[model samples]
Target: MKKNVLLILLFFCLTDAFAQIDIKRTTKDNDLKLSALPYYNYGKGLGITSPDSIFQFNIRFRIQNRATYMQEEGEEAAIDGQVRRLRLRFDGYVGDPRFIYAIQLSFAPGDVGEIKEGENLNIIRDAVIFYRPNKHWNIGFGQTKLPGNRQRVNSSGGLQLTDRTINNAKFNIDRDFGFQVHNQNEHPDKFSYNFRTAITTGEGRNSTDKPDNGLAYTGKVELYPFGSFTKDGAFFEGDLKRETTPKLMVSGAYQYNNKARRTGGQLGDDLFEKKDMKTTFLDAMMKYNGWAAMAAYMKRSAHDPITFNPNDATDIKYIFTGSGFDYQLSYLFPSNYEIIGRFSTQKVNRDIAALAPDTKEYSIGVTKYVWEHAFKAQMEFTLDDMTYLDNTSKQNWYIRFQVEMGI
Candidate 1:
């Protein structure tokens, strides 16, 4: 009985000592007045703030796992699994809050692909400096995503579907070295306007030298006729916030690339010959009461046909003369479940109609947002049908399952 009492007393004494240390640490932390960090995954990331509020740093990491099954008509099926993305990001401000910067890196082997020996690593996803002088004006420079397509601009971590559409895979502006100017004005009566423009090196990212000494110009304008989305909600899918008021945005963009080297502008392999090209984008988004809808149209035209094997005179892979239309709709339930549907079509220009085939795709998916976009599982199946002018048709299908989690 005496030994038992002694043990209990010893336990209490150790607890008290630890408690005092914790109290001292908490008191010191409180005295510094550090600001709380912000992240989609609550309390998952790290942040540090200086005592004087002149500097801040935030770090985050995210990963995506994916599995896919693909089959072509009259062919064997293929199953694959891989780590789709492994990314680390850093974002903060230097002396002033208005002057901010961000650096993002991807370490996935698939993303890095096969690199040649003796070449420097080029895994920088985003490295940009931003200056938001006021609520109405902002300027940025460095390598970053170009404001092009709605789906492409949306972060992959926040998608309601398993993956992006084929149209995005074929014709997204991706990223480039550039300088951008943007502005937005919101009215007191639930209306807003936004404008953006950029001048970028026509070459894609990580290019040490410019091939043609030409630049690309891009501009976009948007109007929110039914008030702006809350917390930039339009960037994410499935109306998670369930806004009480309807929110709508309509935007249009135009781009001109002078002597573009690549077939897909800022992405894809270099063309056999450089050519000038023009691209147009139109999109609309609506969100109301957990219901969301989006539609986009994209068109690209080149000044002349691009041929890989000039002697054969049968190549048109780098022409980049086509149009695509995409539409999507989704509804989020109170239980954090979502159902989504999408349709997309692509048509080659008449000049290359015989060499290229038209494609139409249909897809449907479901997502369980266990913790909003920060943690979710998604599945989607897509049917792709291709048609030739000669009445020949081919069909292919693919199913994908993905899980995403991030801090």
Candidate 2:
């Protein structure tokens, strides 16, 4: 089943590439980009633009491939790593730009878990209908990640944080399946806020329904009353084309999972829980010049139901705090170089501590602009430290170098 789904997705991607006609190109402008990342984690992206029509129509298609080389503890050599994610995405806006729709179907098979042979499956990453009323309000139907962390919102080029923080990956999937709404305040200084709530199966994107029984709720707000020089909808930071900003804020929120039970996937308890376990998160991100730093803490109770086993009979409590930071230092010589590092420590009272791995990493790299954007090269080295479900742990270092060309 998984193989068949994967085949169909690949076929559509290829067909789109060959068609290559921006059939309904928008007169407003034509912006087409194709970026492929073939690194230790191999991936590709393909996009198209059509001539605009009365409906103000546009179409885009993208496909991605992912593979990694992982080294296990007590192992001298590395082995084939998990195929983290295989995905196909379609995005388009309806007439007048009032309504839009998007769908992301994925095929991901891997993990340190038990894999029963002959079982391959695909899941919907984001199947949603989004609408924008005028310019201030945007609402969406379907599953999407809750806006809990600001950095996580920067998806494409937001943070240099080695990986996701403990608060994020543990609390949610970089995303979840649910309905969400957004709002922006343009005139009131550079102020903006987002309030979203959803009722989902809570199961990550890969699997379908189970027996758990409650709705999950999460919301976030941004108070950047001082708007930067951002044109249209593009981001603006300290300078042009920059999205992040230097602001002071007091942000807090909570997420609840109420289900009777759950079965498989990474978060067995993401969905289907009768008891409500609410995790409260509070933190702030501060930016100076091109560098930004962050610290966040969360406290969760034992009453939360696990998708695997739901029973009040077992109750325990846990509190965890994690801190991380990123640097945007610009080197005058030796091309343009940046240094980055992130680390998080976690301790849980009742949860399985073995599987709860704390992550720490350091990455330093440089990007060279050749022929004024005609070509570019990037080289980075990373060192990772992780303690696994087992008592012992392991760490590894890697050097990744790559180049890019665009016309």
Candidate 3:
């Protein structure tokens, strides 16, 4: 009953906000026209614009369906199929071009993950408001992706393969509720640069309570020595545009989570005791003509890895402290078909190697882009090898196919 009431109130609040836009214009002496109905475009989604141009909104949704088959050495093959992702996104300027808002919601079970009691449903992926006072500066508040690794910051829909590498799953700072400041500038025919910083709650997104008085701080900077890529290609995987000139971007980021309660800092299960965690990331991306390449290195550490339960010393959990490397190469053909290859390796600290073993993965994939990333089909094959703490080794082979479409 309470949830229903809250939903009703939210609906009314949104209706009122939309109505207030016209009400304010009616009281003024400015010329105002009726807003047009929503219209759809191929990649831009459905958009609605106010006659006075004071407000604009765009609604977009994407769905990803995937099937996977995997076999371990001396084990039976396993097959799985599911809706990998079902996401709805809304973004636009609220009152003026400088004031922008973005909201994204996830519906697929895999996208929502495991929801704990007393916490949110974990469906809200991003809900951020931005103040772009100028072309070079943007200030944002609310839940969003942190200033982390390049691949982690990139939208999942823009990947060249089926998904990200193991390095990202192990070391990337995914997202959190935070305040971010970003700045970007470019010198014509020379170079470009971007700087971003954030301060956030140490807990990951959708947490109902704060486990401790801790926070996370992150800062990142990127430099492009050969000018910027065509159409913000730095943020997405692959080089679909086939840049006429060579483009390269190098980035570095550092994050410190003071007294974080989660095992993975902003991710993983809750730890019995809080610990300070620090992470560093270095990465670079290069694109020339139809070819693109990327490489990243990540390392993380904690003051103390293991945490023991206060009442029961036998129960324990440890932070994953380790290093990882990921590399990728891809080429986009004029026919809108692309081929990609990737190699990734991760090594956990010996103390936690039992829980998170050393791993290496090799993957190759092909993607057919009907309309760039918005409408695409992907197929990938991967070989995964892991070394356990006991010196035992295991290997697996995986084959996956996925289809993604939006707008």
Candidate 4:
């Protein structure tokens, strides 16, 4: 109890000191606005661990309404409010200067309003602690903001032109259960750099499964020389990345388990090694104005040299590498809005769908924003292509739409 109080006080003190300092725009607006993100879980969280894992995907779309609007007994869908997210965040500081905070909560389908078993989920999305110690440097702790893929980093509030993509379920939480430290003068879109690292228990929310050792490590950096200095220049309000902007981003992760315990059928505890499991993720985003492209690779499991190959092996044992790449493209329309698509193929060694290496995925999606701001909506038509190491494959499809809001 005392520890919790101290934590609360510490958070306030940091924000207080930072908020005491002043800024121009902040001199005007003041107040904690309403926050409501009420998106629908059109589909479930799918992966190799997901039921019917043959090229699985999770889809989200939701309805929303404000308390002011709900008071009249009006439904969110009545206003044609297909808001994927309805969380109103108060983006400001305390009285005066050095602080800034965007305290947020979950109100989505899988978040709030869910009474179903196995579907219950609620979390502090972004109760981050930050300090603008100065202009060039800022520090904070709490769930860290995403800094890998561009489409991934674009806040949900501003994603009116684009619907939420199908990734988070198998990717990053967009939030981590840990602390963060960031350094940047401003929100540098192009040619900016980010360094994020966290020490989290591989267990996302297993509070009782406390450990003093197991931790997950993540690191990534993004640079868009054009995001800053474009043909229109950096200071220009509308200077979108019309020129050839080499948006290069790379990320990698490693997770280790200490005394980790997982149960498998017919497999004894001795047969299952507790060795720390490792996974690597890599992503790259690039664009030359109207033409944009991106790709990501995730390897949840890799072959261990000794167990992978045997000199006396009689049968041809096809060694597996884990989840493969997810690729995408962009076609800049006459309007600033861009059409997008994605392609993914994986050769997983384990699966609840059929057998190993039995899935391939191809997806096409589109999103367009009137301006460079995060305002966008997106939709995708995905074809789940499946395959078996023994020459087998399956095909399925899913359509998704997402309207996101964020500040």
Best by TM-score: 3
| CA error at residue 302 for candidate 3, angstroms | 0.6
Name model 1 segments beyond 4 Å from true. 1-44, 116-121, 187-189, 309-317
* TM-score for predicted model 2 compared with the true structure: 0.62
Q: Per-residue error at 301 for model 1, in Å?
A: 0.5
Residue 90 CA displacement from its true place in model 2, Å: 2.9
Q: Which is the winner by lDDT between candidate 1 and candidate 4?
A: 1
How well is each residue in 15-101 modelled by candidate 4, as lDDT tens digits? 997676443333357633222212223211211112222222222222332221111112232222333345533333454346655
- Give the per-residue lDDT of model 1 (tens digit) for 265-320: 88766677788888888999999899999999998898665656666666545755
Q: What lDDT does each candidate get?
A: 0.84, 0.47, 0.89, 0.45
For each candidate, give its TM-score against the true structure. 0.87, 0.62, 0.89, 0.58
Candidate 3: where is the Cα deviation over 4 Å? 1-43
Top lDDT prediction, candidate number:
3
Which sequence of candidate numbers ranks them by TM-score, best first? Answer: 3, 1, 2, 4
Global lDDT for candidate 3?
0.89
lDDT of 2 by residue, 192-291 (tens): 5445455555555555554445666666655544542234221211111233545433356666655413321225432333344555566555443444
Task: Please give the RMSD to the true structure for each candidate, in Å.
Answer: 7.2, 12.0, 8.7, 15.8
True-vs-predicted CA distance for residue 106, candidate 3, Å? 0.6
